[model samples]
Target: MDHMLRRQIEKIVPLTDSEFDHVLSFFVKKKYRKHQFVIQQGDPVNYEYFVVSGLLKSYILDESGKMYIMQFAMEDWWFSDYTAYLNGAVANSFADCLEDSELLGITKENKDKLCREMHKIEHFFRVKSNYGYVALQRRIFSLLCNDTQKKYNELFELYPSLFQRVPKALLAAYIGVSRETLSRLSISSGRKTQED
Candidate 1:
């Protein structure tokens, strides 16, 4: 499992054998069933998760009890409540599995230790954060500028697996549309194809 995770990390940076071993040594395997909490509201997040398989989502519930999706992590994604992890404060967000999941967890303590022992590990995280930061920025722009039709196409185009793997309501939520609107969009797509 660590071998595969190491390979995933290698997509961004090459790790020497010694560095790989050092990084691998810190990972702890964790599993969760669908709907199981990986982190709960008001709980401190000690671990950052690297997803090997299955889907997990981080969201926050408003006082009215409506959930706002922050992110969805599937294979090869990393997620944690950074505010909770960095400050050692309680989390306002909750992370839960959407399907049975396999994850590699590394605690903030071990990560700090790794940063001290291995510079490459620190660099990898720095680089990874920049990528996630960029993605969040792009997502913000897409939400701000894209039309519903464009958003619908972009989702299918970018993450084809999402159509099959995630539920329709969740996809609708992510796209900032009602379920009926999404259903109509799907039908609209099919009609255009038929006309073509």
Candidate 2:
């Protein structure tokens, strides 16, 4: 867990030995079963998960109970209801496991403790959030502006090798399209792969 955390942090900022130790000391490990809900809408969002392996997703269910995929966090990714977690408000989104997941978690309380103790950890979070925010902003802009075909292309471009492992329906939801539309897009592209 410490190794994984260090690697992930290194991607954003090089941490000193003591800083890494300080951050690692605060993380708590947790596991979730497939199809389990890590967080439900209206719950108090307490933990921000750092994905060690497997898949998790953040989504919102409308009044009709239909889901809108907000994001998927695979290995080395992070997912949480940021608004709720940071502000101590009720979550409007649900995070669930698409596959059995092993995660490193830090609660809002622990993170605050770390931030107060180690300025470096706070800096690490700020930088990491900046990167994530930019990427999310770009993804949202593309989804809102582009056609389905373009969105599919952009998704493949961003997550180069994930199509083989993830279900197409989930991918469709992530790209803001239907399964049938994705099928049509695939056929139109001269691809002949069958779904797993």
Candidate 3:
């Protein structure tokens, strides 16, 4: 688990053993069962989590009670309500475990302190935030211009593990397709794979 966090950080900046230990010391390890809520809507968002294992989904419930999946965080991913975490606002979305999950969490206070104390850590986080922003922009563009097939293909290409780990209905929701449409696409994909 420590290696996982270290590996992610090392991708952006190298950290000496003692530096890594100091960084890790600020995090709190936690485990949640499948279907448990890590961050509930309207609650205070205190911690941003790094997934050590398993999967989690962040989604919003509309006034009509429609659920739209915003994102999924699997192993080695970081997730939270960024607006809430950064601005000290309340969360408007829910983050829940899709499977039994282990996570490392850091409070906003500690995270800010770490960044202030370490230039490399600040750079690392800034790079991560930039990547997250780019991903969001791509997702927005895809939603605006892509057809269902294109969206599905792009999603599958980016996170193939989601196809196996997520349920068809939730996958359909993420792709903005009806369950029947997703089923048809799945069948088509299967036939294509078989022919190959």
Candidate 4:
């Protein structure tokens, strides 16, 4: 499990064995069952979590109780309410497990301390943040364009396994479409549905 995190970090910056161990020391491992909340709305957000296995989603609910998924984090992915975590504010959104999960969480204080102690660690996070920003921009563009089919196809191309793993209704929500509309799109595209 530790090796998984090391692999992810090494993708951006190479770390020696001792350095990896030092970095790992700052994180605390946690496990959660499916449907369990990792971060709930109105609660303080403390840690940014790295998934060792399983899946989780971060989302918000509107006043009318409509859910809008911000992002999903699967194995090797990192997630948190960055606005809350970085600013030391309460979470406006929730993060919950989509599957039984193992994660490594590093608190904001520990993260800052680690970065201060290791310049390479700071570089790693900066690069990761830039990538996250680019992805966010692309998602914003997709939502603004109002092209459901394009969004569906782009998601399918990027993460085909999500079709198998995620419920159709949740996928619909993520793609900004109604479930029935998503079913139609799936049929039109000849893609396998979650039921299959």
Candidate 5:
């Protein structure tokens, strides 16, 4: 677990053994079973979780009871209701385990202390946040301007593993398409892949 965390941080910034130990001191490990909710809407969001293994999906349900998948996080990904975690607000979204999952969680207070104590850790988080922002922007642009096929193809390219790990119906929700439409897209994409 420590090795996984170290590897993730080292991708953005190198850390000395002491520094890594200090960083790890701020996190607590936990496990959840499939279908368990890591967080529920309207709850006080206390921790941001770093996935050690398995998968989770963050989503929201509208007043009409339609569910929208906002994001999926698998191994090596960090996930939370960022606004709520940062501002002490109640969560407006839900995070649930898609599979049995292992996670390392850090509270905002501890994370702030870690960042304040280590410049490199602060830089690593800033870079990660920037990357996360760019990804969200890309997703928004694709949703607004891309056709169904393009959206499906782009999602497949970006997270090919998701197609295998996530249910087709949920994938459709993430792409803002009907399951039938996703089926058609899948068949077409398979054919295109074979041709290539």
Candidate 6:
């Protein structure tokens, strides 16, 4: 599990064994079962989690209880309600395990301390933050401009594993389409529908 984190960080900056050991000291490992909530709406956000295994989805519910998934965090992905995590506020969204998962969580204080003490770690996080921002922008652009078919194709192109792992209904929701519409799109695109 620690190796997973080391690999992720090494993508941006290589770490010495001692450096990796120092970095690992700041995180707490946690496990969650499928469908368990990692962070709940209105709860104080304590830490941002790095996925070591399995999947999690972060989402919010509208007034009428329509769920809008904000992001999916899988192996090597980082996830938290940033607004709350950074500001010490209550969460406005919920993060739930989509599959039984293991994660390493770091509180803001620990993260700050780690960054202050390690230049390479700080640089790694900065790069990661930029990537996260770009991904968020791209998602927003797709949601605003792309038609259903395009959205489906883009999502499939970007995260093909999601098709196998996530429910069709959830995929439809993510693409802002109905399940029936997604099924049609799947068939037309030569992909298996959930029923198939």
**Lowest lDDT block of 10, candidate 5:** 187-196
TM-score against native, each model: 0.90, 0.91, 0.95, 0.97, 0.95, 0.97
lDDT of 2 at 177: 83
**Tens digit of per-residue lDDT, candidate 6, span 68-172:** 888888998999999999999999999999899999999999999999999889999999999999998999999999999999999999999888888888888
**Per-residue lDDT tens digits of candidate 3, residues 46-78?**
999999999999999899998899999999999
Q: Residues 80-167, candidate 5, lDDT per residue (tens digit)?
A: 9998999999999999998999999999999999899899999999999999999999999999999999999899889988888888
For each candidate in the order shown, give its overall lDDT on alpha carbons.
0.83, 0.84, 0.91, 0.92, 0.91, 0.92
The lDDT of model 2 is 0.84
| Candidate 1 residue-wise lDDT at 146 | 95
The reply for model 6, stretches above 4 Å from the true place, is 193-196
- Which residue pairs collide, candidate 3? none
| Candidate 1 wrong stretches, greater than 4 Å | 191-196
TM-score, cand. 3: 0.95
Give the range where candidate 1 is weakest over 10 consecutive residues by summed lDDT.
187-196
Q: In terms of TM-score, how similar is model 5 to the real structure?
A: 0.95
lDDT of 4 by residue, 37-94 (tens): 9999999999999999999988999999999998889998899998999999999999
Give the TM-score comparing model 2 with the true structure, all chains together: 0.91
Clashes of 2: 0
After the best TM-score superposition of candidate 2, give how far the Cα of residue 76 lies from its true spot, in angstroms: 0.8
- Alpha-carbon deviation at 63 in model 5, angstroms: 0.9
- Going through the candidates in the order shown, the clash numbers are 0, 0, 0, 0, 0, 0
